[model samples]
Target: MCKKGNEVDKDLHSLQLKNFMGLLVPHQRQIHAFILYLVVNRADADDILQETLVEMWNKFNEYKDGTNFVAWGLTIAKFKVLQFIQKSKNYRFHFDPQLLELLEHEAIRKNGVHTHNERVEILKECVSKLQTKEKVMLDLRYEKNLTFEGISRQFGVSVPAIYKALGRTHARLAQCIKLTLEQRGVA
Candidate 1:
């Protein structure tokens, strides 16, 4: 009974992760851009974006369906930006705190986030550029929702091998997407 309960909990967590990723990926670039705008440093923006994503995932149960994912994410991102700013004594802001607050409120009110169809197209192209094995790995893990252990068993490899391969593939795709976005003057 304990084993069965553990299995059920694992399955539930997996489902929640899948659902969260489905909602998160499409808005990821937008959230990053917002962070960049607030922080004014690519490295700082990246760190804040990571923090914001973790917070969003942690509080995902509070998110409502059929609502504004970008707006919700931006609220979290704004808080993260402020938190980071407060923490970093060396960081300097071009605008005052009042202006920053106004910008955040106005952005939310205007719903300035735009859908990145071009990003989707670029991502598809990038995925197509991957090697056959890499493509299959991504499909199995993401599209087929296979865990690392499951993928390893299917591919006759160790779980760490599968994990490393997926990590490398993810990094490659992220670089590809970012480069493509820059080339298109979208980033």
Candidate 2:
């Protein structure tokens, strides 16, 4: 009877883990985005995200079914971000606790509605608006994966010129993307 009971417990544990993954896999992106928005450092945010996932899994049995998984995950992420901020003494610029709370609230409010795909599509359009010379330079640097020295050689200009043109192009692209997002009521 004890052996049978142990087998049943094992089966139940396996089922719960499977169910947890089913929910977690879909919401991982949202959770990562929330952490990224708050932490602002990709490496730290990624580490926090992994910690959040492990913490969530450990507490999975406490999670009630039919509740909002994303909300639960985001709540864990928010706590993890707080813990990270607290532990990193050399950060130089720490957010006030109240300000961090407010940002977390705002991130939750804007979570799923943040359209990454739409932004990528808009960025493509903005890139297309660049001048022919600008486009060629961008392609050479980005698509062909050439060094700045290589790009300067190809363009027959100084390295600083290439850097200046790329910087201006980046600023223009950023402005264009922002304006387009605003126009579409998505910003």
Candidate 2 residue lDDT tens string, 67-139: 9988888888888888988899688766778877787888876655555567569889999999998899899
In model 1, which runs have C-alpha deviations exceeding 4 angstroms? 1-3, 105-113, 118-187
TM-score of each: 0.56, 0.67
How much is the lDDT of residue 25 in candidate 1? 86
List clash counts for every candidate, in order: 0, 0
Q: Please give the lDDT score for candidate 2.
A: 0.86
Q: TM-score: which candidate is best?
A: 2
Predicted model with the maximum lDDT: 2
